[model samples]
Target: MIELKSAGEISAMREAGRVVAGVHAAVRAQAAVGVSLRELDQVARTVIHEGGAGSSFLGYHPSFGATPYPGVICTSVNGVMLHGLPTPYRLRDGDLLSVDCAVHVDGWHADGTVSFVVGAARAEDLDLIRVADATLAAGIAAAVPGARMGDVGHAMSAVGRGAGYGMQNDFGGHGIGREMHESPFVPNEGRKGRGLWLRPGLVIAIEPSLIAGGGDDYHMASDGWSVCTGDGSRSAHVEHTVAITQDGPVILTVP
Candidate 1:
């Protein structure tokens, strides 16, 4: 069921959003060449702990995953698409790091993601990241009240397809509130005016996952969580949990 948040509940979720956003900001500052994904996870864990909030991601066991997740944050580097578990693998020059983070504060939750190049930015990688960011912005723009859910995906598709990039629909966005994943699945491509009707209080994570190649074909890693690109091409992802309101879409996961 699609549950709407009360005003007080929305306030609580904003707190969670800020906490997750802080984690992203801290991790962004610490990410650099030679830094291991494990080290970055530690950084996020420290922030989550000091903030007095529990991790919504830790021990999260979805039916598709082989086992419960073990990290506080996702560290998808380079060819890895998403759900990349933190590991001893160190970031190298020109590596594109995609970090997905979530946090729960006072029983509410917020989620967000960011992608960036560590040391030297390759032209192609930079382009893909830029497109993903723009795609996310477009998706957010299409989240106004009364807009069809498919409009959001259609907007995102315009950006990715315009850049000749491949869009990933297998792992798309979803309604987020008490849990990390919820109802009203939001795909990356769809016909406008074709999906659920947008209404006030409906909060959903609008994530744009794009690949550099022609297809978003990917496979899970041995870790049972890491999903990587099948063609070994670099990818980028950007997300923000947004809420439909009488005025417009309100982005919760912002610092």
Candidate 2:
């Protein structure tokens, strides 16, 4: 079932999204080299609590996973793609970290992800991160009413492929409202004219993931949480929660 929010409810979701974005910004600021991944998660926990919001990931257990998530935020480093459980591993120079977060405020949920380079970034690393960001932007641009879900996927895939990066389609975005993950799974790659039609008040997250080695295959990490590239290549992911409004797509996870 696709859930649509009212104008007033959408306003509240946007507010929740602002808090999530703020949390991401705070985590990024504290993610310097030598900082442990657990430290970053602590920053996220603090920001969410300080913002008077509940974490969408705390103790979250999905059918696909064996155990409930144990951290407040996901910390995917280099080879890891998604579902990276925050651990005591300390970051180092040139480590590419992707932080994924979601928060629930007043019964509404908003999710977003941001990728960052810890120290000096390699040339290709910079390109991979840029591609992920651009891919997310393209997907958001295609979130207008009258546009099919495939349009967003295709746009995101084009950005990744054009930059010579491998795109990951196993995990993508989804419709978000009262819950973090709702109905109507939104893939990162799709044909241009299929799937559910866009309507106002429908909020969703559009995430684009790319690997540096140009290989699309991935493997599940032994931790049973993180997903990494099969060839041990670095990866980057970018995401944003947006709503299809009368004024095109409104990026709720931004100011």
Candidate 3:
């Protein structure tokens, strides 16, 4: 069932979101050419620990997962779309990297993701990241009270489609509260007037992951965790945790 959060509960969740944002900030600052993915993960770990927040990704073994997740954050590089495991591989100039993170503070959870270039950036890669960021903003704008979930999805998908990008069919954002994953799976594409009605106190993560080659096909990596594009094309992912309130849609995951 979908659980509505109270004012106080939402406040607590904002705290968790702050920690998630901090992790993203630290990861972004530390990610560069010559940096190993494992080192970036450690940066996130330090931020989470110092914030007194627990990682939502570590030890998480979802039904589709082959084993418990071993990192505090997912490090997706270039063709790696999602669930990319951190490794000893050092980043190279012009590499596209996406970091996904989640955290819980005082039992409330928040999740978010960001994509960027390691050092030197290609024009196409910058364009891909721009579209992904735009889609995420569109999704958040559609999260106001009384709107339908499909409105949010439609808003996001329209941007990606217009940019000639494709999204993963099986993976998208989800309801987040005390648990990292909750009821009411949120899709990236849908009819504007369809799906669940958005009510005040409703909280959800809005993430848009776009494939530059305009294909939806992807395959798992040998590590049983990383998801890479089937066509070897690059991708970008961005996200935010938003809450619907009487005033408007409030983004909880901000630094």
Candidate 4:
């Protein structure tokens, strides 16, 4: 069911989001060539605990997964799209890394992610990351009170389409609060003025994922978590937890 959060409750969620943001920042700083994904996960864990927040992602067992998530943060490298499990593999120069994270504080939850190149960044890879970031910003801008959910998706997808990029509708953002995942599924692509109506007190995560080449095609890895481009092309994912209020779309997870 869709839920609305009070101002005080939103403040609490913001706190959790701040912690998630700190984890993202700390992990981003730790990520570099020769760094293992597990090391980045360790950095996130340390920051989450130091902030006095509990990881909402650890041991998370989604309906589609047979095993619980083992990492505090998802470290997706290169062509790996989403849910890329951290492993011993060391990041190489020019590797595009996407990290997704969530944490709870004062009974509220917040989730966010970032994609960055390890050392030297390729022009196309950099552009893909820029698309993800810009699309997320546009999506958040449409998350105002009284707006339809479709506005957010349209705003996001339009950016992708205009840039000649492909969007993945199969997996997208969703409502987030006391739990990691909630209701009112937010797609990265959709028709304008359609879907659920937005309102005050509503909180949701706005994530836009795009593939370098155009299309909705994607493939799930054997790990049952990691997803990537079907054509083996590069991809990028960007996200933020936003709150719809009278003031506007408040991005709670900014670092």
Evaluated with lDDT, which candidate comes out highest? 3
Candidate 4 residue pairs in backbone clash: none
TM-scores of the models, in the order given: 0.98, 0.98, 0.98, 0.98
Tens-digit lDDT string for candidate 2 (127-241): 8888889989999999999898999898888888888888888799999998999977888898989878888888999888899998899988888889999889999988899
Per-residue error (Å), model 2, residue 199 = 1.1
Off by over 4 Å in 2: none
Q: Which residue ranges in model 1 land beyond 4 Å of their true spot?
A: none
- Report the lDDT tens digits of candidate 4 across residue range 65-88: 658999999988877888999888
Order candidates by lDDT, high to low: 3, 1, 4, 2
Global lDDT of each candidate: 0.90, 0.89, 0.92, 0.90
Runs of candidate 3 with Cα error greater than 4 angstroms are none
TM-score, predicted candidate 1 vs. hidden true structure: 0.98
lDDT of 1: 0.90
